[model samples]
Target: MRVKRYIVNALPEAVSMIRTDLGKDAVILETKEIKVGGFMGMFRKKRMEVIAAVESGASKQGGTELPQRKPSPEVNAVVEQILQTAQRSSAAAAVMEPPAQPDPPVSDKRMEREQFIINEIRDLREYMVKLSRQQSDLHALSEPMLALKERLQEQELDSEWIDKLIEALSESEKSADRVYDRVELWGEAKHMLEEWLQPYNNAEISRDARVVHFVGPTGVGKTTTIAKLAAEQTIKRGRNVGFITSDTYRIAAVDQLRTYANILNVPLEVVFSPMDLPKAYKGLSDRDLILMDTAGRNFRSELHVSEVISLLQSNEPNETVLVLSLTGKTADMAIIAERFSKYGIQKVLFTKLDETTVYGAIMNLILKYGLHPTYLASGQNVPDDIERFKAGKYVELLLGDAEHE
Candidate 1:
């Protein structure tokens, strides 16, 4: 048999090329896609690959004997790259191409208005195609993966992060050449989540930082979190603890910290401004650990965030932790985290875990803003309801028990 390879723009083009090169009797033995001609392995053009053959005697011109072949590692890599390029090119062409004009190009007042309408229609078409692709991708997942996706979406994870996870699972499916069962899918998700969060894991509160400041938006359980940490340091570790309240903005906040202080027999100092921080620190100088609680305001405002950051000024061995609530929306939390992150605050504490089941915000905050989570506060039962952040356990809670799914 005589074989010929033809690279063309499409199947019809390939058929035409084959008939002209190898005559009408040539049969299409194999057909696939490939890419060609690019600088530094990018900007390559997509083309169809056709392998055709004809009987040696029928051709009246012989060809080399055919041999069975399999892709080596390098060839496999090129194939994978070609598949990716083809997919991207196909999606872009489908989504971005404008409809063909019915008439020759012209410029006029009416045509200008018509062009604007056409552009708007084109944008709408792109949006609709985007929605259709999202729906199709979601539908492509099996029941287990679909359930996991729903769970993540319900937990308020960003769509970008969700797409990344689903894409990973889909790639795994391709690599294994089989669909993963529900348990396997869940397990894979859990493993991937744990792997991602592992680097930020076990970020416990420093026992050595004499001054630890807790800052957050209003009603995020900052004062309560302070009390919990104080209780842990004072009762569990048998270390001397003190409290300094810059939360003088609220009478209830002062009274609340005092109540905890009175119960724990820890000294409490109240500060009205950054000026008062010096006096407060002096009074708590003898204490092994001084936990400072800042007033939670509309930290969403950059002005308020700056006001809070100014109050956090401390010359001693100190670290600031940005406290966030699980009860809050991820977008708002992200804004708050972003505001705090700008001032070099990296450690985070989450509260109100018992109030919300959605935990994707934890991962989002950690990965998005590079905030290291130190503790998870669940309830009001001082020190008892809180625990240090562990990536493995958090992954279990975030993804649930994989096998049980």
Candidate 2:
């Protein structure tokens, strides 16, 4: 794909150009806002970079070209020839000794302006070259720059921010500064996650051995996580463990828990109503740890939240664990955690770490909730993917190994 970069003052106008010049067959790859010129012009004026691609040999499909399309092949050919002439002239000048320099102020200013315009033009020229060499489909470059443009208007619109935003959007495609390193920064992030997740550690699981409730949105691995914890306490620690599931709403949920209980040789109680809470506790009152699995609730739905709240508050679980998926968007996770905060969540369990490539949302959740996580459920492997949440480990994983060195 041929990737052509155009610096226009507007997006629609650039899009129009691509549609008209390159035809409707052109595909937008990336869009960004960059500053041109210096001081006032660079900060105050903004230009959009439209990175588009089109098949070089593609004809107007289904026949005839669009009406009134300007800058035909002849015009493009002439422009190309002129650019080629300019490049040859510039190269020849590079090898020759400089003439007596121009007057001080005029020379400096002219040089700056010339360099700026040349850099911009060079970037576009390189993009055009790439567009000519590659298959159109291989040159996808579209990026979300509207948000960056707004930020540029409000904050620093200098070349630095423009480049940083571009780098972030094209992270998978390009290698910029290894920002994820900075061990000190990773340490701070680790501390923040630990502080938020600190509550999930059930130090009193063997003491009071009271009902520990797990509540969260659907499919957060609460049942499987409970099993992992139970197995750890039973087989590893030799702590007497019992499981009680209030997730009688789904037959599979009960059977799943039952299967785990059967493997552990521990008693399992299914509580469908608030009255069944006492019975569930009585069935496993002698165990060292009572893991109560609650029904999954949709925090967005008032009815579902109310129902789950009623169940949890009826007996007031000694410890409430909020199970959240780290794969969810930061905004959505924050809102859900806040909504469920009313349930008196003492800790959090972040699941689906294997599904997410970035840890930004995890940072958001920890920063927002201030509930330390007890475990990170990475996969569906029972007792295998579940691991104790360690602040240092998380920091290391987030920043990666290269960051520390």
Candidate 3:
């Protein structure tokens, strides 16, 4: 980068100088107002100081090379003296009466030349003052912005989201410390994340909905998540709940959910095929809330995803909850969500939160697929480990600092 500084009186003059010296590609880096040319601080004149930069190899007009230059101490002193004298002369002229006799032609020409120089100096001063104010507005955000970027990267946030966050944070005013206050920065970041996540933050499980199906790829904790929700409905909410498993492909999954059914004292129905779904639903007809657990399959197979969807079709108007693990790769989650989209999956439940510290995948999947996440399963604990998704709490979790009692 080739950086240059200009001290001038007006914004337009500084801009013109930058364009002339550094080319149109020059970027304004910083600017601030400074006082120059004062005697005993009584005649202090305000000017702008601008810091601009251009990338190396940027093309300059006229195919000419200009040597890099810095304002020397003597040059600055001379400029200050000239500005002070011009200001005094201007002030004196404004107050004093004109001479009784007209000046001679030669002297008038000299005076006009001097007046032109003074006008140029005044314009330079105005340019500097404008540049200074612009730079001051940005200066307060510099440190805080750097800190915020580092924090977002440390959290493994997406680059696009990070850029947006930094832009938003930059537009706001900084605190008196002139640095990003950790708590305040996090609060703003959380708010921004929550807004991006708001449309997908929905995890509501309708109480009146008879059947809620949990479906996803293998080993994503589908059966356990169902057990957690079932327990919540039956034990805590005082509502009658039943379990229907189309997951007979794994006897282990069947046995595990059976254990949960026994503990909760709820009925469990096992469907051997899609044809058996109607009978299972009938068996749980009296239940207020019926939670269905579907077999986790290789969702990449069109046939397998179709099979799951067909089984879900046996129970129409049912809520399909796609169970995804936080530990899974984002690419796989997206594919799984797309494959299951045919089943009309409306809600998503994320499991294995305790397995990974990075939670960007959750937000990414929800935003990408436009799906609502209804529950978060942090651990293996059947009921206690699951909670309804709260956008604020989830944002805090992603931002990394939860207050402890």
Q: Candidates' lDDT values, in order?
A: 0.78, 0.62, 0.74
TM for candidate 3 is: 0.61
How does model 2 score by TM-score? 0.51
Q: Evaluate residue 307 in candidate 3 and report its C-alpha lDDT on the 0 to 100 scale.
A: 87
lDDT (0-100) at residue 338 of candidate 1? 94
RMSD each, Å: 15.7, 17.3, 17.9
What local lDDT score does residue 98 receive in model 1, on the 0 to 100 scale? 49
lDDT per residue for candidate 1 within 1-405, as digits (tens), equals 888888877654554455566654566554455799999999999886767777776643222221123323322332343344345544454455443675533346334434433443344344434555666665677887787787788778887788899899889889999988878888888888888888888888776788898999889999888888888888888999999988878768899989999999999999988988889888988999899888889988999998888888888888999999999988899999999899999999999999987899998899899999999999899879899999888877887765554
Note the residue pairs that clash in candidate 1: none
Best by lDDT: 1
Q: Give TM-scores for every candidate, taking all chains together and pairing residue i with residue i.
A: 0.71, 0.51, 0.61
| Candidate 2 residue-wise lDDT, 1-405, digit = tens | 566789998554564476566655566555556777678554556787767677887553321332222334532442354344345444554445355655323346344534543554455445444444432322333322333233333322234433444444446324543333234333433454455445544323324435677888887788988988888888788988888888977659999999999998989988888777777777777887788888876777767877776666434336777888876656667778787775556468889889875554554455455666677888887678888777666655554443322
Ten-residue region with minimum lDDT total, candidate 2: 60-69
